[model samples]
Target chain A: MNDDEPLIRWQWIADHTAELADYTGIHLRLGLLPVLFGLIISVPLGILCHRWRWLYPPVLTVSNIMYSVPSLALFMIFVRYTGLTEQTVMIPLTLYTLSVLVPNVVDGLASVPEPVRLAATAMGFGAVRRVIQVELPIAVPVVIAGVRVAAVSSISLVAVGQLIGQGGLGYYITRGLQLDFPTPILTAIVLIMLLALATDALLVLAQRLLTPWSRNKVTSA
Target chain B: MIRFDAVSKNYPNGTTAVDELSLELAEGGITVLVGPSGCGKTTTLRMINRMVEPTAGTVSLRGRDIREVNAPELRRGIGYVIQHAGLFPHRTVLDNIATVPMLLGWNKKKARTRAAELLELVGLPAEMAKRYPNQLSGGQQQRVGVARALCADPPVLLMDEPFSAVDPIVRAELQAEFIRLQKELHKTIVFVTHDIDEAIKLGDNIAVFRTGGKLAQFDTPERLLAHPADDFVADFVGQDRGIRRLSFVNAAELPLRDGPVLPATAPVAQARAADEPWVLVVDEGRRPLGWASVAELADGGTLADASLTPLGHTFSLVGDSARAALDSALLSPARLAVGVDAEGAVVGVADACELSAGTTAVQAAAGEQASTEAESASSESRATVGKTSADTPGGGDR
Candidate 1:
């Protein structure tokens, strides 16, 4: 079939199995590493920022600015300095992830009931022990929920990396556009959406596994 | 013993939370710190365990300054309870109670075993040990909080409005349970509350604080009620201070009259021949049934008839306070308080009029004793002054 003759071009897709595998691997890493990095960096920073309290607004403002910057512009701008390597793509994606995850982390930690924290202190729990044993465990559901959003959004943003020639799934859409065919574009969009949905589902499953208690309505004791 | 020696907490915002509060809390008794909101009662209680640091002076527990001990170590040794129980939601009730024991490095099995014992001690069933805090009622959670505090068997307990969050009925039940526990445990406790009645009911020594954080009066509940330090204390104690003072008086001292009492199976003629118009009817076991009227017997009413007036209530002179006896007299249909023994058998009775007279006599006797003691104190001071003058040549210059 000619590139533009049949609408789907299924034969072309089957012949490009190796390319699909390569692109899928790249897409998965591009989407997930930022989330992993974001969580590692943001959670501790969020906890520290929460403790300082005065540091929170400034950190949030900087993150919000980073997140609000267009992904294409951030990637292109970093390309000038980092010379179009994976770092150019990964850095902006990680920044966006941090913006979303940090607030959620802070809010999750803050959501712990004051009385519960007071009780921990009154019961002789030191600051470190209380945070680790009581606060973090209680904050898990909210923190995991934030991660789900970051993962899904980061998956979509990975497609934006195509503007700087590092797009994983979006590489197909770019080629399809260059060739003026609709099949590759449709396939890429479907695959990206599926990846986002799958990642979100995994996060939700992790939340359920981690926090069985939060599922029930907590009556005041 | 916990002693606060001129301890003051002056906030950076220029508000004095606690101002030079000097007080000594006797060992093995409950000392209540109570006042209006923002009066620093809570701060004072917190200072006992170094939760709130004093700005001016020292707070020593058992002769050691609390600041010298590691905070967590000091706190583990001093049990703390607050309003709303403050239980850890993630933990089961057993684990919540086992917190201190676990902190003290007890094995899981031992901590849980002690936790189960405390669950029962606070009047909870053993089955509730596995349940979470939210699964329990507010009152039950408060009980668990108490049990958790007592788990380490700390000699000192600091309770910040512990029962205030529960309903009135539950609060009373918890208060009664608290009193019963204190009777058995005899832990030295410092309780903070806003309710004057709670302080009066639970405190062996009540320290009433003014709004500005000054100690208005520090005295025993009875003495505080009978003789407030100033108008601030008098008003704080409220207009019912006289009635509250009755709780401190002993009902056993009241004169008892064996008013006409008849057996439940007594004949109508025998009831009619009784001296009093109203006759107390007793069962075969000598347990009081109700008050019967001689007039009813005279009107051809048999003892089996249902013309008997119900006994409002009865008081045990052996264990009851004068206030309880007065309450009994006021509640009775015949205006008489029935006195009963441990076996529920009728002993003697007192009318409301007689109780009031007895209370007055008791007060007069107390006043006489107080005056003689004051005169002796003054004379002894005078003798000391005279001795000083005789011994020291500098006294002549003075």
Candidate 2:
């Protein structure tokens, strides 16, 4: 097929509209759950790891190992356990996000000025309250940088889920090769690329809302 | 009243931030902790609220063991302000000021109302309550910080270099505001600053901490200025500390004396005093006219009333510093510049003799302290002169 035409036609997508719907749905579930869950879990762990240097080595080592695993193998390892359900697809992809978030969270927390923390203590903020109110707000830019990287990777990796019984956009690539129908593969690739761009833009919007200080720093400097 | 009972702290890396420090802080007074960096002055202040736990001994507030009370509760009862104000950037100024009160379970509307009132108490406008910390100037942020500390009306306040972040003019203004607030609120205060001048200006009592956490001295500002406990304390206070002490005196206590008066139209002879040759001439309303010598007046011509010998002017010290009076008197071309009231009447004048006499009396009273201090210096100087000094040469040159 030419670059202008996908291996499969738009008519085929409309013809199997129900099948297309199932693919998009599962893809969303697989990437969305893991990234969101991983961020929530790792942020606190990062904060804890930061507070005590003694806890650092173990926490860093686990994240480093997670980063080393390739996407396809990671998905297959989880697939054997859950037997091709959406749970199998979601777990391993989400797990990939931990490595990205933990270090960034720790870095962000570490970047918070010592004077700021002492000021928090002097102003009578106890440990828990100070972290929530002072450290977290100041650390937003660094943490957002991590989330952005993790999120983009997660969206792209949704393609690997096609190896399981549930196929997402990767179905068009595999199916097109078998039948020599290039339209389906080309169209799916275009749509996936667009989806990635749109999601990244949304994250940038979220960053502005969450970290006003970062925006001020950019504008002022 | 706050008291430190031999409190000490040694960090794990073998940094002795504080040595056994014992001192009592009077209720309703500002006790300034002042010294060079790493002097453990900050460590001593932190231990009061248990920000830094002491390795030995304890700090008690109003006779209750601080360790017996819950740390949060103890902190809540003591107001604290620090550099940069540390207002949570995410929160509005109103929310920042209301932090401690909210923790104490104040209702939302009530806490917000109280926070606005506190902003005014610290001399900030009410509209500032809606602005975020980043939106405010350094001075405004500091004021909001002070407001937050006083929100719960805690009986004690702790400040750590609270005005250091702002520019000098703002720092002075904040210092003045704090002094006025101390007069009104009279909370037991432990203020930490490295500036000896600020310590002298703000402290009812000054506690100077040496490096390695030693308490060099603890005494009233007058005594600390008049008689430092040891050489280390004196050097830390600096050679110009006497000049800083000048700020302590009000401008209404010095003695005033009358000078001879002369009329504008009168011949110099009529204006001159026979005994002193030169007499200060006035315009009858007692505003100083000029000086006239008896020789010029004795010539007895209409033109002999020449005002060419105009009195060299100085600030009318009317009733302020003896030094102001003394300085004006010494530099006076008329032997004494005329002191005048708001009405421009010649109130009085002081002469150089008065200044030297007063200086001698003050020195004589302070000299008795010189002997006891000399003995302490001879012994301590031989030991510490080499060890603690980094930039300082053989100590006590001044």
Candidate 3:
């Protein structure tokens, strides 16, 4: 098959099926792991910042600044410190996830009604127990929404890591570009969007499962 | 029992919420803290559970300083209820009520059992246990709040405007139920309210705070109404305090006047002879059936054939207050209030004019009785006054 063949190169894709599967798997992990790790780190951090009113502004400002830093610049900064490996791509992607997630976690927890908090405290719920049992469960929907955004954005941004020789599905895009062939690039782009949608849907389903109470019409008690 | 000794809450900005308060609350009785906005009633109630710590002096439970105990531990043993119920929306009514018991480490079964019992105690149906707080009406939610606070049966309860969020009708119902429940539970309670009427209805002792957190007066509702200590207290109690005092005056001594009566079986001639403008016809049991007008009966018709006007109301001298007796007379179509015995048998009747004249004499007697009561007043006696039923006449004279 010629590298300059028409964009619908079915025979070439069929031949490289194993390689495509490997890159697809890598693409998913690169998008998903950072989200999982980011939630684990940011939710608690966000809650802590929420608990201490003075800590919120400073933490939010820092996260906002990190979020606004160009993704390519962030990736390059990680490369200088960690060298050309998966860590270079992963560390920056994870940071971006945290930047989005931390504020959502804080906002979600803050959204809990003041009366509910007072009720919990008056009923002898300790500070730690109240946060975990009452607040975190109530905040699930909002926090999960942030996770959905972070995951989709992370999946798209992982393709930029191809500049550092560590692309996931982005390997196909780079290869297509080098050979002046549009088929692989378009296929990879389409595949990336489908993957983002699938994962976003999964997060939404998880939110529904975790936050069953949010589905009801709630009036003030 | 709780005690506030020189307790004061002074904010860093130098505004005092409660100032140099010294008071002792009796065991198994309700002590209400009430006044206008920013009068520190809520602050005082919160101090009992240490939700707000006093900047100076101490709040002690059973003679031990609250500061000596851990706050969460102290609060666990002291139930707290607030306005709008402040229920956890995520939890079902059962779980919300079961909160304190669960925190105390009762097994789920036991905690839930206690919660069910409390739900019924607070007059909520058993089926409400599975419903979320948001599913309930405001009144029902307040009941759940009460049930939740009482789940662990803490000997002390602190309430801050717990029923104020409800409509007037529901508020009255809640207040009545609260009084009934207090009779059974006998928990020492500190209640906060801005409504003086509520304070009067529920409090064994009412602490009326003025602006700037000054304790203007602390007395029984009767005393507060009968003899307000200062101009501020008198104004706070309102100009209608005299009318409110009538609630404590029993009608047992009000003189009953006889009205012309005839049995339902009496002949038309006998019915006419017994009638003044209207004739009261009684059944064989001597229970009043209705009033028969002398003019309404045809010349040859029997008492049963006469057109009867329905009795507007019946008052009981045994349990009714002078206010109630007055209301009965005012509502009567014949301008007379009938007096009934325990069996609903007619005792006698008094027309509006007679009732007014009689009430003045009764009020004088009640005034004398009230003055005499101050020297030997006790909560036991006051409790009796609150639970007055037709079977147990509130007045000494019957």
Top candidate when judged by TM-score against the true structure? 1
TM-score of chain A of each: 0.92, 0.87, 0.93
At residue A201, candidate 2 shows an lDDT of 85
Predicted structure with the largest lDDT when compared to the true one: 1
Model 1, stretches more than 4 Å misplaced?
A1-25, A81-85, A179-184, A218-221, B293-301, B360-398
Worst 10 residues of 3 chain B by lDDT: B389-398
User: In terms of docking quality, how is candidate 3 classified?
Assistant: acceptable
- What DockQ does every candidate get? 0.47, 0.23, 0.46
Clashes of each: 0, 13, 0
**CAPRI verdict on model 1?**
acceptable
Write the residue-wise lDDT of candidate 1 on A1-221 in tens digits: 35447777898889988888899889999999989999999989999998999999999999999999998889989999998677788899899988889999899999999878888888889999988888988888878888999999988889888888888999999998898887888889989999999989888888887876665555644
Off by over 4 Å in 2: A1-22, A217-221, B257-398
What are the iRMS values of all candidates? 2.7, 3.7, 2.9
lDDT of 3 by residue, B1-398 (tens): 58788889999998999888776777889988889999888888889888899999999898899999998888899988899788876788899999999888999999999899999999988888888876789999999999999999999999989999999999999999999999999999999999998999899878889877777777778778876767788899999887677676676777887887678888889866764777888898888888887877888856877778888878787888766777777786667788888888888888766766776776677667765674355532332211221112211111
Local accuracy of candidate 2 as per-residue lDDT tens digits, B154-226: 9999998999888999899999998888888989899999988889889976777778777676665766776
Give model 1's DockQ, 2 decimals: 0.47
lDDT of 2 at B338: 61
- TM-score, every prediction: 0.88, 0.81, 0.87
